[model samples]
Target: MTVALTTPMLLAAGPAHALLPNRSCGTVTSADSTAAANLNKVLTGKLRGSMTAYRLSCARAIADATRARGLPNQAAVIAITTAIVESVLENNPNKIDQTSVGLFQQLDHWGSYEQRLDPAWSTNAFLNEMVTLYPNNSWQNQQIGVVCQRVQRSAYPSRYQPEVADAQRIFNALTAPAPASKVHLEIVGADGGMWNTDGDYAAGEWSGSWASLGGTGLKALASAVTGNTMHVYAVGSTGRVFTKDANYSTGQWSTDWAEVPGNIQGATALTASVTGNKVHLEVIGADGAMWNTDGDYAAGEWSGSWASLGGTGLKALASAVTGNTMHVYAVGSTGRVFTKDANYSTGQWSTDWAEVPGNIQGATALTASVTGNKVHLEVIGADGAMWNTDGDYAAGEWTGSWASLGGTGLKALASAVTGNTMHVYAVGSTGRVYTKDANYSTGQWSTDWAEIPGNGAGATALTASTTP
Candidate 1:
């Protein structure tokens, strides 16, 4: 069945609120003062001489197709390497070789002109055949080139071998775990109104109707993607936590709000992370200490009562889970940053809070994400500037010095790492939304912030996640 892409409908609007900017330590970069810019760009259709663009376009199509079929990265690598050897990853409708065309030079027997020409469709068709040839998951153990050769039955079977390295490089670059797909964005309006975009920032639109599930006095909101579902959590006016679930494949949200079993104070900060099939939530309790709860998605139930993590004077908290290791960060009342580590496999949490070195102090809001073995953190400094610190979680070493990304009047902050790209969303004191993008592998951020439309004044909370 062909899935028709639909535009997301616009949601409800609300009144604006004045939010004070938090002071943070950092030097303002003149480049960051400019208005934000859009980073979403489609690379499909016909390809020219840009090898980088072609590789990215092919990788995206393959990734989407494989994901749809519930296939793994091995299948993606097979499809990409086949395309690289066949047409150098270009979409060539004009190329005529006994009716073969498109990225993989698929023949007429593959499908009709349109179907064969569509990057995603062609890749899907190729993968379906590949899976049929290797249904036992044995393809995972074979050389990528050999797998492609078996599927394509090309006359030059060895041609695919030479492109294996390049194919793997491109696949790794495009498939790195990202906090959210580059195409999706989640926003919380005043009065706890929630909205999300369905497509990429370049072409996606907000939902038409806002779910009135949230209430006034919503202090912090967070989201995480687990399998094919997106989970959103919000702290309502009554100091209670509410959650809503959405099926990313169908773009449908649950009709009612489910209250989480916890008693958090109003204005408490909340952060969420997902590893395997379990969802972890951390928040500042009424006692000003960090508390946590776990949601088992596989079991469809919450586990245990809220457990105290044993830290005092905790203000803002953020958590990141890489595999079974969960890392949590928070700003102490004295303006210092402290971290705790947990290993779920061992069922253990760090014994005590350890201050991050460099004497970094005075951060108001904190957000964190992990890529590989590295942990990246962004904080609202006391000087009202954005400060970022990164370290190797496995090695226990940090950069120590906080690097300034440069923005003023920033109130709320949220971040997600998708593929090899890192995205940070902030609601300025004016209540307008701005975003900055960085290549997570390079640790280089875009110079200017791009303003996201539709999120008008009074965007109190912001969270982001890629569709699973």
Candidate 2:
């Protein structure tokens, strides 16, 4: 029997009904930032006209709905496209349609009027409908038309095909191929920025700033940015590393500024990870050497022990870590990319730098997940283009050829990954952040970028999930 739900009951139980299966897009568990960059260029080019607003709103609504359910953070292209085809998301606002209204155009009689108008409620209902209809099929793999028909059963099912392509295009613009273990950060200003830091471990649509930690001449450059449960770590002026941690439980932030203890000519960049609650920070020391630390991110523990990973061409950049291996790559003084992977399991890091097949001038990023047997990397070419590399971390098979992903407005930025999709997000020189995703189906990148809600070169973290 169908149970009647009151407004309070429905609101309280919203998390159980969102679109994502198990409702959590596992943290950026795997990624292909290089592919993500390429797709961003493609999708940005595709977004235009009336389609732009509808597509954006759809994607935004789906993302919001997923978050409301406490489900894994999902990119919104699929549900957005579904709405684009179903209702064009343009029902009259002044007058109500008893049959359907809002983004999904839900029929009012099917549920409460309030629920029908709510973005989260509509998306959750749609996802639940899909699950009830196709309990065993893989929604991610099914053709768009097939998946849509399974849920909508529209009179002209075939008419929905074009929207599937639209959905796929948007999906590729949103889903990440892997996790963001390494991110490129560049601080453009000291203006306190407003952001949501509690979830996704990132700053979104920034505005306003924290209490000023006075340090003028805050020149920003491309540096490695990493995170832990309680703090964000980045390279400060003159190559010093700085950290800011929060005690959300206590609604407090540590005010003490502890400088990285290291004798260096200058610091280049920083990368870090949190494993079993311990924060690990890695950076290029003043002598053009690699330095690392293992300490309490919340309590501020950094040893500043310097470890030299030898190579003549080090241009201090970013690094990403998995299981026990840390993949470090950078743009050399000569503009070529030099990479090394530290395998903690063997108690030894790679002794020699293996050159990735391109000349990079910015930080390189990497990410991986269990579903894929590979690690993926992305870097900015000396030509200001983005290039990518994929390798089998466990099999020791490396693919080092560089492929060009074109974009004109991208600046130094950060990325995160999930599954076989790579989400590359970058701030435009115009101060707008853009995003695009690369999927495995076409084995190619989307040709445009979608505008994000805010600005800043800090980082654009991503995660994804699918409902049954």
Candidate 3:
């Protein structure tokens, strides 16, 4: 049978004021010795010292999580009680175990070890299990012993009451919540459009009727951080640079693509690091030189007019924003990456070009961030090999010489880096999308190629979704 925890399980034991006083658990009022002993057995060495801190942290976390689910304060109590009775605030150590690992003492055999050890993961698993066992949630009253007897069917079912009281106290004392990490992710879908979400794999499909656009409709997907929305400016098929937005919120798409001042072609979209709501759009001008327009906006309207960024060439890739400045690198026919940018306030373009060491141009996928102000660029070399360079863009120095990550199959490459984790995805000639993800925690990229879901061969495009 699928066991679960339900709403009723969260009901306060006794009077709310009498049972738990103030914001603190009052006077160590445990239920009974029997319940206490069972709790002691499970809790063991775990719940010593900092009782106040422990109780506050756990209680707050439980409350925060339940609040999102529209649950009341009592459910938090239930989660706390269960956690206290199980691992006593100490998570299970990392090691192969016959039983599931974690604060819930889960056995590794149940699932992957990596997931089992994650605190949030363990909490989620326990909550799911609770949902399964106590579908009606009337289980809490059996006292800890009777309730545990119904679910765990422990060898010693009689020892539930004592443990329950301790669990309750721990549940009450530790009630502070964990802090949330704020981020902004801008997702560009296949249709020359952009949206925002904090999830991975943003979803949208080509809704076009034209057969020539082929089943080959665009999916210009991209993701950045979380929270902030994307600024998009593109040259439409009509020979006009049409702009729109799908950043945060819902219901309707932005209407009317605005026309830019100059006669342009091959326009690419990018955001500025130092300026808020500023988009730097680069395109090949009528003279075949690279020209750009910089405009700032908020709430989906342009506040600044399109301005000129003097340069030349078809080789331009937007640098990830850093502080108040953003770098745009370009390559001419010789196949080398070049750089230029303006500070946050003036929004002026640099006068001269600086070449990156080694012949590095033509169809490149790049990613960057503020941490150390670093940049990573990959390109399909003349020999059809994949070469990468990593270094500080502002300093114009390569940290290390160019390294060949792999060969041949690097077409349509897209890269994203968050914290220390770097992920690169590309379509292989063999008709499969290949992936390389670096785990920041371990400081290493995974050695195998992970295939994306629902995509195989046949001209696939790779974009990372950093929302959910």
Candidate 4:
């Protein structure tokens, strides 16, 4: 299974957003560094309170993340202003009140402690909710402080206004553009041990060699990233689910497995996404119904018990998110593909599942990636070959036929996108993993599938997630 929740892809059909001219992330400019260095001297007097170089950099991160989502300048102002009011523009990890933390003083309800403390992840989470609350561009007519208050539900709601001007200048200075980064990968290898490596998009190569995170009996897996913090979930042969945490920022991985709460046994296929306040999960439960659950995984808890999504005899789950709406796909018992939508902004789901019209049937694995407004769906067909199609949520349609991505004896599969190219990996009948790439710019795929080197043979299932 594959899920996409980052900013829209860098597409071949058009240019990047004007304010965020670069597709890269996590870069701060030399000029911005100088400005940050001078902040203590220049901001001795307060707009509401004084800001240090660190605080200014936090403001810049907030600004960059907001603009990357193609949101307006005012959205950045509102987010920065809210952070200033809540934490004096700091990414505070200490719980201040009622489990509250982060620059926005968000409680664990917003996410795990690590998520709130990650400036990039926290910024995206704030924007996710703001867009949801202000659906249909409603925030444009409201005051910036009012928008902040509505999203925050703060006890002291009036403080945000006094800091808006300061936030606006900070947002402007940091919105110039930044460098690029790709979502790094961790795979469950042939040995049932976890293996991870970093990728360099600029060099088109793995930045590091595959290294092992020792484990055994892991059959299937899914993962989600909140900045560099990764929460990995795996299903054992007996259907018991286990989770582990990896903080790439600090180069550490937890040595023990933690059982996720909520009696999530007998789950077969799984998918997860990083949303506004939590890591949302979709599992094909023991009863063959799609079940949903989410939580602050860093703290080892689910938001609640798993609730059924009510699909009959479903398998092979893959989901994608576009503009606050999530499109979930499943392969029904009869081998037909079905889909439903959840509008996060409105807190509603499509009334029922709709059959996707195509030659796609008897799918054992499904994975998808979003390029611009369209989702490119790939499936391993009943005939043991790969097929591709597109679902355009903006237009509310799916392709009537499937094109051949061209692989043979393929088993389980997963995909991820970086820039204009989509990378796909699949488990072959021999249990070895092979990959191929599709270039959106040239509408071409590698003529022959290339096997990924190293000890990844004998893999059973694969999952991939994208992070901004």
Q: What is the clash count for each candidate, in the order shown?
A: 22, 36, 57, 2
Which candidate, 1 or 4, has the higher lDDT? 4
> In lDDT terms, how accurate is model 1?
0.74
Q: Model 4, 136: alpha-carbon shift in Å?
A: 28
Q: Which stretches of candidate 1 lie over 4 Å from their true place?
A: 1-180, 198-214, 262-267
Candidate 1 lDDT over 227-252, as tens digits, reads 87889898777667888888877867
Report the number of the highest-TM-score candidate.
4
Question: Which candidate, 3 or 4, would have the higher TM-score against the true structure?
Answer: 4
TM-score of 4: 0.64
lDDT of 2 at 23: 20
- Model 2's C-alpha root-mean-square deviation from the true structure amounts to 17.3
Question: What 10-residue stretch in candidate 1 is worst by lDDT?
Answer: 34-43
lDDT of 2: 0.51
> All candidates' TM-scores?
0.62, 0.48, 0.49, 0.64
lDDT of 2 by residue, 158-178 (tens): 755566555556555555323
Root-mean-square deviation per candidate: 18.0, 17.3, 18.3, 18.6
lDDT of 1 at 318: 84
Candidate lDDT scores, in order, read 0.74, 0.51, 0.49, 0.76
Which number leads on lDDT?
Answer: 4
For residues 249-338, write the lDDT of model 4, one tens digit per residue: 686889998777778888888877665545777888899988887786456568668878889898788887787877788999977788
Q: What shift in Å separates residue 189 of candidate 2 from its native position after superposition? A: 2.6
In candidate 1 the C-alpha lDDT for residue 98 amounts to 87
**Candidate 4 structure lDDT:** 0.76
